[model samples]
Structure formats: C-alpha cells, structure tokens
Target: MSSPVRYAYYSIAASVLTLGLKFGAWTLTGSVGLLSDATESLVNLAAGMLALWALLVAVQPADDGHAYGHGKAEYFSSGAEGVLIIVAAGGIVWAAVGRFLDPQPLDRLGLGLVMALAASAVNWFTARGMLRAARRYDSITLEADARHLMTDVWTSAGLVAGLAVLLVAPPSWAVLDPIIAVVMAANIVVTGVGLVRRSLGGLMDKALPEDEMRAIHEAIRAVAGQGALYHGLRTRKSGPRRFVDFHLLVPGATSVARAHTLCDAVELSIVSRLPGTLVTIHVEPEEEPASFDGHAVGGACAGGGDCGSCPGAAD
Candidate 1:
C-alpha cells in the first residue's frame, strides 16, 4: 500500500529472479563458489517473502487485542532473517569443506561468471534503493532486506573474482575455490550476528536515538515556551512508530480547559516533528506531591510502571 511496501514486493521479485540465474550458472560451471552464492540467494528468496508478510501485518490498524498495534511483527521477521543467514552460512561451510576434500574441475567458466555478475548488478541497484526507502520509512524490515542484498552483492563479486583466477591457475590451485567459499561464509556470519543484535534491541523496545530524543525535548520546550514544567519524559521505538509520554505540571489556578489546550499543542508539535509518533501527556497541579516530580527521575528510569524508588515519584 505504501512506497516502502512496494519496495518489499520488488525485493521478492528480484530474489526469485536472481536465484534462478545464480543456480543456472552454478549448474553449468560446477563452481563451488557459484553454488555458494546461489545458496545465499535461496535464503534471500525465503527472507524476502517473510519480510513482505511481516510488513503487511505491521501496517494493520490497532485492534482490541493489540492496543499498541502489530508493529513489533517487523522485529520477528528481522530476527528470522538473521537466523536464516546463519543457517545458510553453515550450509556454505559444509559444501566448501566437501569440495575442498575432492577438488573438481569447473566448466563453462566464462559463461557462469557473466551470469553471476548480471545477478549481482541487479542486487546492487535494488539494495541501494532499499537502503534509501528504509531510512525514509524507518522500517526495520526494509533495512534488513537492504543489508541482505548488499551482502549478496559482495559475495557474488568475490566469487566471480575467485573463479576468474582459476582460468589461468595451475591444477594444484583448485582448492582455492572451496577456501574462498569458506571465507565468504565467514564474512556473512558477521552480517547475521549484527542483524540478530538489532532485531533483539527492537524487540526489547530500545529507546529513541539521542538526536531524536533531543528533538522530542526541543518540541516540548517550544510548545511550552511559556515555561510550563514537565517531568517523566520517556521514549521507545516500535517498528516505524515512536512512543513518548511525560507528566505536565501546571499552576493550580490554571483551568482544566487551559491545561487541555496546552497538552494538545505540545502533542501536535511533537507528532509533526517526529512523524508517526504517539504522545501522551499526564496533567497535574504544580503543587502535587514530591513523588510527582521524582517519578521519572531525569526522564531516564522507566519507573517500572510504578512510582519506583525515586523520592518524588507518584505512588
């Protein structure tokens, strides 16, 4: 439905097409390196389909069972992709070790390299576009997809270079094919671990980055430019959405209508600046108990959904 989602669909198409091309190349040349590259493309096909499904679910409106919406589904998809990467790497290692034990001569050298490079070129362009879309939408699904494609591009490039060397290489150097495959696997292991780490952080509801957090603070200050007091500032990101909430301390003489108006203004400012952000403002009298002021303690501690140990935190 959205631009980012459209890109996801395109990714699926690219994965299917490339997988076919790479496998055909591997079959023709019998190059273990090309086989390794093609194997990774298969994983890409599966991951792309999963990402599409996750993005669809993530865009659904909040329902009774999911008050916060289904945005976290994207993290699950990302984590799955990470696991898939590791699995693919293991498969590559196993294949490489086998090939290393019994080196085999390759055929159709020139043709295979051409096919592989063509697939890589498609991925190169697709990955570049996906990276741009990911940043624009702040969608982890697209980011993971982009990272996967970029890794594929590099792996394909390495395989082509290694195969090209075999064209003039002595017969004794055939082992290099499998060894290079092992190296490619090692390189992808790092990518898998990084994706898994990012997915877990999202699942844990990581706080916004320092820059965006600063923006949230600035928006609050600008909307309450008259010096209204606030505390209990907190923020978290869920998929493409941001959540922020805080306490608004107003003078006791201020009428309810005026307090409501101020809260409305602050929420509008933040939503406008952050985009897709949800803000909650809890209004209270300036003279409220000390617990109110200490509740959040510099706006860092989560307060454990209670007053917490902060002396000024509300009960």
Candidate 2:
C-alpha cells in the first residue's frame, strides 16, 4: 500500500482502540463528559475507516471515465467525516442534556480521568505523526484524519477537566460536567464546519492561492525570459497533485518545434521549483503590439523595417 493508505490504516486502528477504551471507562464511571468524549471517538473511528477507503480510491490511476483521476474521492471522504463530526456533536449534546435532566452519580472519577488522559496522549502522538505524513506526501485524506485525531485529543482533555472538576468541587459544581460537555460539542461543531468548507472548496475546484499563482508566474517569466508575456493562469488541487495551466505568448517567428521546446523548458523549470505539481502550457503566437513595451522590439528587420517577429517587436 502507499504511504497514505498505511497512515490512514494505522489511524483507523488507533481510533478503534481509543473508542473502545473510552467507552469502557465511561461505562465504569458513568461520567457524562466521558460519554461525550467516547461519542467523538466513535465518530473518529468511522471517519478514519472512510478515510482509509478514500486514500485507496484516490491513488487509483486515471481511467477513461475520469481523465483527472480519482483524487477527488478525498474531498467526499472529508465532507462525510465533517458530517459525522456534526452528528457526533449532536449526540454529545443530547447525552449532556439527558445527564442534566437526571444527573448520574459518577464513580472512579480519578481512574476514568487518568484513562481518558492516556487516550488523549495517544491521540496527540498519532495525530502528530499523521499530520507529518500528510505534509510530506501532500495527502488530503491523511490531513483530514489527522484533524479528526486532534479533535479527539481536545475533547478527551476537556472530558478529563470536567471529571476532575466534578470530583473535587462542591455539589453545586456538578453541573460543570454537563456544561463542559456542551462546550466540547460546540467545539466539535465549529471544527466540522471548517472541514466542510475545505471539502466544498476542493469539490468546487477553487483556484490556487494567490501566492502559488504568483510563484508560477515568476517561474514562467524566468524560463521565458524578459520579452514574453503570459496570462490566463489557472490552477486547482486534486488530492496530492496541483494542476496548473497557463498561456504563454512567444514571437511569431519562433519555430513551432523551438516554441514547444521552450514550453517544455518552462514546464520543467516550474515543476522543479514546485513539488507535486503538474503543468500544462498553451503557446500563443504574438499577434500584434497588443501589450508590448518598446524594449521587446529588438530592431528593424529587412521585410517590414522592424523585427516584428522578435521579442518586444511591437514594443
């Protein structure tokens, strides 16, 4: 399996183990906060499994049906994970409200809190590793999985705090447990919204960031040199790949083969500067002095009294 698939698989396994442990602790302690944390873990487990599947599907080679490949599967997986997080938050709110209605007497608060803390620590490490892998590989699925794990860590920490407060504080503070659970649920909902936004952007083929576009422009100019002009730059992301397409204007007299060579050279230069990027260049012959500056025109030629076919000819 690819690195992304391996990372996602391990993440899914860790989430499953975490869910089971947190649920068991909740059963023993009857802590509403722990229940909320467990619910989030359940969502994490489901999301991780789906992420693994998405990683697998995303790595598939481009087929006749999908010329751009199956990378967008990651976006669907991410959106699904976001929806699951929202659902988990709703469940958490319901559990917290139920606990407020009929508060359960929590037991072994210290032990349960310790267990939750341990689970949180595990998640912290797992999330860090997954995030590192995602950055190195530029894998969207792994990044989403990492975000889910980080959410688990935060929710687990919140649960630990709520339980600790409930144990030491006066009876009047018992409500803090449910209150913290609500807060944790709200936090999850906020994170879910962000994930959904990113997924939607990916699905919608949002343009590349301005900085990236500028970088491409610089790279093209560097390869084409001073005389050439470019426009109609566009870009999009597909899983780990960046698709960049742009138009380049060259002198009319430049041979087609040489222009093709120059285009290849520009692409190579850009690709060298950019990692995990695919570029397509469309060459357009310089028609007239559409936007040329004086320096672009080298000198007068024999035919038209001007090197109109030369760089900056109209200029």
Candidate 3:
C-alpha cells in the first residue's frame, strides 16, 4: 500500500499486458525482433515481482539481528534483474542469428507494429511514473526498475522502426530486421551492465552523491561555530537511509552541556537537509593533547598542524 509497493504492482501489471501484446506481435509477424522484445518484457515481469518482495522486506523495521534493516535486499533484486537482462540479450542474439541466416519473410506487419507500439507506450508511461516515485522516496529499487522499463521502451522503439523499414525496403534489405535485433541486444547489454555495476556499488556501500555531500557540508557550516572544527567526515548510503559520521573538535573549556547542544543542532540541521540520515558526532576537546594525522600534537590544535605552545610540536 506504500508508494513503492504500489509502483511495483503497476510494474507487474504493465509487464503482463505488454508481454501479451509483444508475443502476439511476434506470433503474427514471425519477427525475431518482436520475439526479443517480448522476452525482455517477460524478464521485466519477473524482476518486478522480485522488486515487490524486496520492497516489502526493505520496509520491515530493523531488528536486533539486523540493525541496518533489509534495504540491501533491493540491490540483490536489481542485480538479479541485470543478470536476467543479459540472459534475455543472449536469447535475442541466438534468435537474431538464426533469422539472419534463414531470412524468413514477415507477415501481418500492420497489426504487429501496432501491438508493439502499444506495448512501448505502456512502458514509456510506467517508466516515467516509476522514476518520479523513486526520486521522491529515494528508493534505489524503484529507480532500477524505472531504468529497466525505460530501456525496454527504447528497445521497442528500435524494433518498431526497423520493422517499418522492412516493409518497404528492397529484398536485399530484409537482413536489416535481424541486424536491428542484434543492435537492440547490444543496447540492452549496456543497460544490463550498468545496472549490475550500480548494484555492486550500492552493495559495497558507496558514498552519497556529490549533491548530497554538498548539502551536508552546508548544514554543518550553518551550525559550526568559532573554535569548532570537523574532520574525518564520512557518509554512505543504503537504500533510502544515509549514515554520516564525523569528529567534531571544540574548545576544551566548553562545557559538556554546550557541546551536546551544539552536536544536537548540527545533527538536526543535517537530518533536515537529508531525511533518514543517521549522524554520529565524536566530540574531541581541542585543548586535549592528542595525535593529529599520526603526529603527536599539543592541546591547541588548529587541526591542520601541531600545537605551537607544546614541546616537540610543529609550527
């Protein structure tokens, strides 16, 4: 009933409808290109189902056994979808090669083309909606699904254009149909590889985008005060959640209560800028003699170099 779940359902329904339409087109015209398009839709349906389940799992509250929640499960779904896409492309290549060699004439061109167009239309609209929802909620699973659907729309468009050309071109150009199918396979291969790479990146705990990092910096700058410095700023994203950790250096003379207040203000500012962000600030007394970047420094550290007033300290 959540927006992501609803979008998943929409994806499943659309895939089913488009699958039927595309296969019908393939059956009517015996075009291998249409068959390949239908096969991708079939992959879409399976992936959409997987995405639905993943979304459900991801929504579950974190438990004692799994403190970070089940959001990473969505990445696995997308990775599997990417592998499935590659398999679909392989199937397409095999079918295309056979058709290219045999050179069979297509039939009922008009109806098949119309059906293909209808399927593309559905994909185009669904992809747009999914993308909007994904950005709004910061759900990578939905975003992956949207990207997959958009690829399908492009595949459908290429097939439609190729088939239309086949209808009027010379007999020598009949080979164009299978060739177009091969080209589409290549296109989807790139899409699949991209999805896989993104899946791995997410699973490996990639940092947040530059824009998000900039926002974090802005939030910190807004709350940071004189004699307060930050270091070891780190950020990572897992699905809709963000984790941020940094060391906050403050004047050692500052009271614990005041430091806590400052920490709260900075944390709240970051959370406001980035929803679902978990911030951890380690307060360090600037007056405390501590190591800075492996160098033993005096209490009064500007954070870049050693303290000036301490023995054996750098200028």
TM-score of each: 0.90, 0.89, 0.90
Q: Count the backbone clashes (under 3 Å) in each candidate.
A: 6, 7, 0
lDDT of 1 at 13: 89
How many steric overlaps does candidate 1 have? 6
lDDT tens digits, residue span 12-35, model 2: 778878887898889888878888
lDDT score for residue 232 of model 1: 75
State the lDDT of candidate 1 residue by residue for 200-250, as single tens digits. Answer: 998987778878877777788788874646667778888899999888777
Candidate 3 local lDDT, 1-315, one digit each (tens): 777889999999999999999999999999888999999999999999989998999888899988988888888988888999999999999999998888888889889999999999999999999999999988888988999999999889878987898788777777887898999999999988988988898899877777887787778878885434665566777778899877677787889999999999999999999988999987887656462322332222224322343322442
What range of 10 consecutive residues in model 1 has the weakest lDDT sum?
Answer: 300-309
lDDT of each: 0.86, 0.81, 0.84
Ordered by TM-score, highest first, the candidates read 3, 1, 2
* Runs in model 2 lying further than 4 Å from the true structure: 288-315
Comparison by TM-score, 2 against 3, better one: 3
Using TM-score as the measure, name the better of candidate 1 and candidate 2: 1
Considering only N, C-alpha and C atoms within 3 Å, which residue pairs clash in candidate 1? Answer: 290-312, 291-312, 291-313, 291-314, 294-312, 295-313
Candidate 1 has a TM-score of: 0.90
| Model 3 residue 290 lDDT score | 61
